[model samples]
Target: MNEKVSSSIPEAEAVIDTTPDNGQEGRIIMPEAERARISKESKKEEAWYSGEPFSSWEEVEVAVNEGLLVPVADSDHYKVSANAVEGGRYLTPVAKKMLDLVAGEWSKKMKKKGEDIDSLFLIVTSMTRIVSYQDGLSKKGFPTADSSNPRKSTHLRGGTFDLAFKWLKENRSVAYKILLEVLRDLHKKEQINLIEETTIGVLHVCVNPDKAKRRSSSRRLAGTGSAKR
Candidate 1:
């Protein structure tokens, strides 16, 4: 009998030290003030890209079908969780492009380190979410932002994603460091906004809309097509 492939990836045992002081050197920490500022800025950008918040899963599907939101699947550098796909596996074009750029840079860095890039991939734990799902999570004490307030969560706008850090730290320690380096570089360039959600053990990332627009325009002017889903 043939074995069926599991939809979910199994998390590796916690081999790496989880202590706060262990491997703390050169770690990127986003200050609370910076996170607050970025949160506001990201909300504005999200509003610009996704007009009204998705109130239901049907609305999310409609947006996907209409191309307002693009589906993100497993790729060479990243893997979307089964739960993320089932909840809402979509993002704005600019956000998706940003994700690709981050993952691509991390892959390059991993290759330079002589690591097996194929074995290292970022695990996306969450993506765009409908209001109902968000509410459900909130009720379950999942630390979800307020779903009633459209400006509260970028995930509602399909412009944010959560990367599972605990799994990466325990399983792919080197890749996790490289990933942080890539994120730090991008954040310095003001190309993205990041929030380290310690309570959730995930890094929440939001792409900067202005930078994405500028890059898209530059590409067009250079006769290069815009990034596709």
Candidate 2:
């Protein structure tokens, strides 16, 4: 584990208001074609991880206990928002690894640039959510993918999380740019899917679960072969 960074960044400087407001006045609506593509790909990922969405907090707890889901806490590379994600900060083991990889890469890049890595960290505004919580967001008229079908939500699958951009840009402009660069590199590598939700002012990220599964299988096979020696 890396050295934990101090959470001294002012709340006002790190928090973003994600609450719904008036109609989509200045919000950037995703194109219908692009939206459909993201949904289709995300649905495939959901199926790969869990066949169904977590229906309640109890389900989440069961997944955690079964080692299917892991708790995501504030780390040196990132901070979990206290207000935005009310459901719970949890993610699949593979998703947590992906998040840490991205954050670690960002830290290395910042260090190479002679930047103060201690003062720079990504802010995760959202994580896993129960079906009921998804329903509440839908009732509030928030833009959610397949709100009517909670199982289609990637967040419920526990492989998706939102990174705050508005607050980062407003407070730490330089760190914001570097973080984008890191995400772009990872996106190009097909290690993750990145969705810039301008409407909500956050970057929605979904880790590639299929690839992780393949890697896990490969490791298991190798271990078994070595054991047979």
Candidate 3:
């Protein structure tokens, strides 16, 4: 690890670690102090774009199925219940279907390692739209809001949601890794142009499954990139 040896506990700026990508450096950097400041401001920024206060977050366990978790169509109230997405807006019909595909794909993989694939949740780690509207898009446990959208706030339009594993033992579910591979594979076969996402190895992936993959194999065949967004 290329330790920069900052004099003190510098601020939390965007860091460019030269490790994960085979010694390749990160594309961004932030001073330690700037990081803390941004983090403080991130409280209200919205989860999808930037800040997410972990302290204020509450983690709860929920179930996942091999189908869409939220509802589609328009309604005065959220199509999905507050339980599914968690403390945010409701899940779009598209988002629900995506959640199911991920949960199922991950579960099947995790089961091999004795992981509780079913004990997953539609985490709302940031970008809290509203209570009743939340379909489990948590406003918790994110570093800082730095996207065009930001975290802890609503309006994370497009079919996106934060997902993660809860009671796993010994090792993190390899299912997460599998999920990425499947996604890349789908990108090849289906040409599903899933863009502007963090390849940050999240325990869960927030994506639009309908156009992305199917629930059956979680290995939705990748299409061509001809439909690049």
Top candidate (lDDT): 2
1 or 3, greater by TM-score:
1
State the lDDT of candidate 3 residue by residue for 96-175, as single tens digits: 55555544555465556564433232222222233223323222222333422233332233234443222111123354
TM-score of 1: 0.71
Worst 10 residues of 3 by lDDT: 7-16
Candidate 3 residues lying further than 4 Å off, grouped into runs, are: 1-89, 110-155, 165-170, 186-229
lDDT of 2 by residue, 1-229 (tens): 2243444546633457676434775343445665555455454344444446678888888777777778999898888876655556988788889889888988888788666766567778888888788887666545566635655677876878888888667656666788899888877776677777765668888776555553323221112211100
Badly placed stretches (over 4 Å) of model 2 are 1-15, 20-50, 84-87, 147-150, 213-229
Tens-digit lDDT string for candidate 1 (1-229)? 1122122344421221112332545233434555454445444334333344578888878777766678899898788765464848888777888889888998898878876754556778788887677666555334433324433566777777878777666556787888899898877776676766654567878776666764322221112322221
Best by TM-score: 2
lDDT of model number 1: 0.63
Cα-based lDDT at residue 101, candidate 2 = 85
- Distance (Å) between predicted and true CA of 76, model 1? 1.2
**Considering only N, C-alpha and C atoms within 3 Å, which residue pairs clash in candidate 1?**
none
Query: In lDDT terms, how accurate is model 2?
Result: 0.68
